[model samples]
Target chain A: MKTKFKKTLYSLSFFLLSICLFTVPTFASGLNWNGHFQTETRVNLDNSALTWQETNLTLQPEVVTNNTRFYGELCYRRSGLLSQNNSLLASTNSNPIELNEIYLDLYAYPWRRMDLRIGKQLIPWGTGYLLNPTSNLNPEDLRDVFDFGRYLGSNALKATTYLGEVTITGVFIPVFTPAALPHQQFQALFAPEMPSLPFTVNEQKIESILPAENLQESAAWGVKLEKHLLGCDFSVSYVDGRYSLPVPKITLTPVGEKVDLLCELIHPRRKIIGFDLAGAYGGLGFWSELAYFFPEEVKVTSDLTAIIGQHMEIVTLKDTPYAKYLIGMDYSADHLYFNGQYLHGFPQEQGKDKLGDYFLGRLEFTLNDGKIKIPFNACLEVRDFNKFQESFAYLFSPEVCFYPEMNTEITLSLRLIDGKSGTNLGKMKDWDEIGLKIKYSF
Target chain B: MMRKTCCILLLIICLTFPLCPVLKSQELTAKEILEKVNSLLNAPQDQKLTLKLVLIDKNGQEETRELIMMQKGKDLRMGKFLSPASQRGIGFLSLPNDVFYVYMPAFKKTQRIATRQKSGKFAGTDFSYQDLGTQQYDEKWSSRLVRAENEQYVLELQAAKGNDTGYSQLILWVSTENFYPLKIEFYDQHNKLCKVLTNHKIQKIAGYLVAQEMEMVDVIKNHKTKMFLEEVEFDTGLSDESFTERYLSR
Candidate 1:
């Protein structure tokens, strides 16, 4: 069956290639290429905490005209993780990390458009603030899916149709690294450090405990409605996907079996329903969104499955339902603009306290035709260990950017972390860092 | 027999002599037509004239405005207002390019109108910049007798060279009785019927005759506007500085 499916896919790809090669010359606008490279470094104030440094290089080659457009970007990144307290101790990749993005856009029709991207791309969806459909395939991280922010090297096909002021779009994701995979040689590529789990994870049962890796593919369809009326804008969407899973080792306990694992690599089927509302008038504007995710089934390993089957005493346990919401406002006049936003995520279903709740806020002020901008942001996550929520950690960052010209930008940023236990702010102030970056965009 | 012959001769001679008056009016020659029109146009150099101009469009809505026109030789200064808020000032001294300037109080500035914008609307009206300038009898038009109709010669005047006037050409009907232009139709650069210049305020100023009030309309936009000459003068001393760019920008 797998061989047959592969053959059919290969034949379809060949057909598409031929069509592109023959039809492209007649529809091409003009050839253009743009690229940029930048590197940034961060250090702690007391030189007593961890520092973060990274470099990014990207290039885009595009063809554009009155009706048709085709563009793609190639990107590379190199990062170094360091301990401020121990200056000599740091982890750096001996080689650079690279990702590719390529997409072809078809805008031939006046009412409908299509985009087919076959490589690394940002798949942002829903109106929620957190707990989104972010499937960053960090194979090295302990918590596979929910911990990371962006997915890499995923293939997607999207189609959008416009009717008056409303636009409806449909999308499909295929052959991406599944968020449920276990640690491997490329595990570090996902996140700097993986979170720790309470249960003992036997090497043999790891595969069974997680969904299939990049080998598992999924398809999702979504419908959205947007309307602008009475000085306010509103939109809502519903999305669903069916995914495959990878099997894991089964452990037998005397009182049946204990299964503690993450199943359904993507979800046999997952649904996202959300909406956004915004208003703009005079110098003030406000926007907000709320979204809820419903899964047909949540997978778990034999041990975790046995534990759940026995109704273990874990509060706000794994595979719990959740909801996310975000609100923001902006005011602008002449050359100056100020904006602020707050986002929150919490468990929607009772007795499922697996994922922690997060509160995030950001403020930005811009000056001089976007030539200078100051930004500050804070995020607090209340960790729910044993499904019992307790202490919270706050992450704060303040940054400033100066763009003298369209091609060049300079920025200074700082990162700080603080924690609180119950109503009292904890004494754990482990990390802080200051950073600078110079970027040239073409 | 001698008595009978005298009577017959007398009757025959009376009938033939009565036809002379009919023939004389038809003999309105080309030179005679041109001379009369030129003499009427040669109004006194310094006399200012006022008139109420009424413009009627294809839709038959008539717009009326008051105008003050002063013409000194080939130079002219004109001010027009159908209403208080719709006033405009124009000055043109015919030289090489017929240097023209228009003052719009709303903009608080005067603009040196180029030849291309000559056919555009004047002060948000159907009348174009070309419609604002005078169509001197001899300066712009070269006439040919198309045919004699009634007491007027329907002269078709082709625009003069170097003049390369805005109209592809202009056709005018001048009265043989006073050499005053009765009706003029202007064709655009594309040789399309663009405007109709109707003389409503035809009057004699000093020894010269002028259309004290006239109306011009755009055929496409269905708008009619009038230019009324309130005060007109012939041979007014309009200095070169009046048409300078600095003055125009002012």
Candidate 2:
């Protein structure tokens, strides 16, 4: 039976590969590739005492010729900080890092309407919306900078199929993490656990949750479905196995009058739902999601009381829900493109009564025989305490990008964030950054 | 004898100068070639075309399908591909960058695809996002005659002063005999050749001559796809409502 199963798997793979080789020819009529390199430095104009300098060099090479495709990227990053006497500071340190991404794509179609794609590539779930399936790796705000050279996703095997107006994608993610030396007597000291219960394996204690020794070696799976109907496009995603991190515990609830009550800690799972609509009349797009985390050992108790009492009564305890919603509209004008978006995120665990909100606006205009394209992007945030705490947390940002030629662009960005009366927010300072970038594309 | 030789040379120079002016006038400039092709394309009072397509690449493998096309002066109807689950049945594409509409037959509603998305693929075929538009070359492009080769004039065109198009420049080769387009190439803002369109199988239909088979290939990719027109009807009696979402759902 085992031999037969192995044979069947091999046969299936052979058949699929043959189909791809026949459908998508492996050669292009002309060879086309593009490479872009950018070096960026960030300085805090407000405080010379606190300064950060980083240089990033990235190279992306892609070849699309004949009917076959090939693409890969390589990147190196180095960052340093000079901290003088400050109220709160970590350590003055400089670090340089290098990373590598290598992958190839092959496409083929044997079935009448089905196309197969095999590669280690980023699989975006929604159409450049908030519920991005590939956001886990290359997380960037589309309104600000374009970081196409960043890693979009971990290495994975993926397949995409089209049925009528619906597109379905399935991916198998291969997780890989670095190994560390064995823990010696002193090395184990930082492990931190009760002497009797060295290396506690309790899934119940919300605050002290760690992954299994083989967590990074396991495989995760994700699937996405998209369809365009009427004037709207809708997509839903379900992913399992290590997609999201645990949500911090705000309170603990004890089990029913037992001598040893249950300590509850919960984290949210990752799930996404999104929709978009664009017609001749106008364009409306929206996306919303609910993520919940559940700690293994935590039991839901009556009138739960952990860490902070009664405050978490608002939270169901076992599964904490973190939610976000976005709505946008686009108006089609002859010489101008105008659009606006609203985003709101529900706090996961930081506070009981606060949620974050964002307002975004954009405009693009053309002139001088299509030689000059002027673009404007603006954003405003309200009640910004969703994932973390802040004293006067409000965010406002605006940017303008100009295209002098098809391959050339220059951008200027202005940003401001007002925290509460007192808070220690990391490298993020309330200041404006004016930088310039030039690109040569083929 | 010397005086006679000088007079004869002078006479020869005068005749050649006059002929140069006449010859320049006889030859069409780059702009004139573009205008000729545009005139022929826009001359048809009304036309409705339904054709079958067989897309083939360099490997000689092919996918067969059908499409219905219509054009009435400024209005037009491009092909609506109904195959493969991904593109299935989409709404017909209507023109003008402002009023571009796509009717989804499944939803029984016409949705408008964004203008920015017009450069994407159509029906998962080899055609580009911009190929679905009912763009009038004369209205959208300013033409200049580059040169003539093998009885066909090459025309270089830029987007007209008031028009907004994705391409920075386009080079088209038109046959002098019927003004039929033989081949065309599109360049992006970076002057990179992005798309190539070729017309083959020229035939005559109801007193109108046109290419019955055509292909649109992505020059930069290994994928070069073609669209073959089996039966083309030039002046079919198609109502304006045929282009409407109401009729599309039916």
User: How well does candidate 1 match the true structure, expressed as C-alpha RMSD?
Assistant: 23.4
Task: State which docking tier applies to candidate 2.
Answer: incorrect
Per-residue lDDT value at A306 in model 1: 48
Chain A only: list TM-scores of all candidates.
0.67, 0.60
TM-score of chain B of each: 0.69, 0.79
Model 2 TM-score? 0.50
What value does the lDDT take at residue B144 in candidate 2?
76
Total clashes for model 1: 49
**Residue B27 lDDT (model 1):** 73
| Tens-digit lDDT string for candidate 1 (A1-442) | 5446546654554454445445665678555556677877666677544455557787656565544555555566665554545342333433253434455655525343332334334445432233332221211122222223333334566655545556565565654233333224223222221234445543322322222333343444556666645545567777665322221223333233322333221234456677776554333456677766564533232334444444323211223455566676655332344555555543211112333456566566665424578877776766644533357777788889986544567989877776764311122254466778988865
- The prediction achieving the highest lDDT against the true structure is 1
